[model samples]
Each structure stands twice: as structure tokens, then as C-alpha cells.
Target: MRDHGIAHIVETILDAPENMTAVNEIKERAWQAGFKAGYNECLTHVNPLFKSGFTDERSGFHGIDIEAVYAAAVDAYNNLSISAIEDIEKCLEAEDYVDRLRLLFDRPGEEDEAAGDAKNDAGTSGTKVD
Candidate 1:
């Protein structure tokens, strides 16, 4: 039947390896973009927090430990960056066409169910529910 042939063509196009690859590439690029955006946003807030200050002590006038401060700032930045990336990744995974396609092809395994449980435990979207 013509309808069957059309359905076959649609299925072929959807299941094509090249199409899957392209979709994966697009998802990766989107994730990278989200990471960059989150990093930049965090940087904007963190840059001003790193400042040198002078301290008056009984011994003598001394400047704040620049090295220590820098180290702490770097640690905070790294932590913040990681948190931001995770949040963004969660948001991406929660609602995306790439994940939809993946779910379509890949049957729900135990790991998948666990991940779904985790997602449910964390609430639906990345944004605050309240």
C-alpha cells in the first residue's frame, strides 16, 4: 500500500544513522553553549568578589593574603561552575527533543528507571517549584 510505503520512508529517515549522529551533535553543541553561558554568568558575579584589601594589625600594616584569597576564589569559581553546569544539564535533559528520540529508541532499563526516579525526586524542572 502507498501508506505503508510512506510509513517506511518516514521510519527510514527517522532511524537513519546520519540523522541520529546529527541530532547528537546538535545536543552536544547545545550543552556546550549552556555551559559557556552559565560559566559567563557566574564569572560576572564572582569577579567583583575578588578584591585586595588592607588590614590594620597590632604588628604592622599588612595586605590581605592575595594568594590565599585567589586560591579560595578559584575554588569557589570551580564549584559554582560545576553546579551551574549540572543545573543546565538537568534542564536540558528534562525537556529536549534529543532525549525524546533517545527514549523512543532505547527501552527503559533499570538505570533509566533509577534516573527517572532521581529526576522525580529532584522535582520536574531545574527551576524552583515554589
Candidate 2:
């Protein structure tokens, strides 16, 4: 699993005007929730809100204020004292994400097992990996 930087994500989302009101309402609710919980609970919440490489229309998030969700997630991430936000950003950007992630994490992706079989599969079944 990967934890994207919710704070930056929320900020970028709120960057667009149409998302303004919805984000604000969510923030307000988060504040109320904090009061009820006796602490700022928004400081803890991080999970995949959306996949790394998928585009979704705003309407699909009828009740989900992306900014709020991200804000809480980022807070959770920071509080937990962990690091992986940068890699997630690169993954979201769609520009050589895997390579970027490898560089950020100081490792390389798994060897492509299908590479050797691609030509054989294509010749026999007219199917290709890409």
C-alpha cells in the first residue's frame, strides 16, 4: 500500500475554484469532530483516496471533500513520523513514476518476468504485453 501526501493533494484540490465550498464544509466538520474527540483527530487519517493513475470527475465524489480527506491523511502521516510522500507525488505525476519511485526509495523495480516471453506469446497468440 502507498500513502500519498494528503496535505499537498488537498491544497492542489482546493486550488480549483469549484471545490471551494465543499472543502470548506469538510474543514468545518473536521473542526467539530476535533472538539468532540477532545483532540484534533484530523491529525490521523491516511489511506488511498484514489489510485495512483486514474482520473475521476468531481461529480463522482458526491460526499467526499478530497481536500479534507487529504488534510487529515497528511496530518496522520506527519504525526506517525514516516516518509513516503515524495514518492507518491511522483507516482501521481505519471512521468516515469516507477523510475522516480525507485530513485526516491533507493531501490529498483522487480525484473519484468514477461519480457522474455513477450515475443513468443505474440507470435503464437497474436497477443502482446504492451
Best by TM-score: 1
Which residue pairs show backbone clashes in model 1? none
Writing each residue's lDDT as its tens digit, candidate 1 over 1-130 gives 1113235335655556655555565555555555555555665666677753322332221343434544554454344333323433554455452334333433334233322333325422222323
Q: How well does candidate 2 match the true structure in TM-score terms?
A: 0.21
For each candidate, what TM-score against the reference? 0.35, 0.21
Off by over 4 Å in 1: 50-130
**Candidate 2, which ten residues in sequence have the lowest lDDT sum?**
38-47
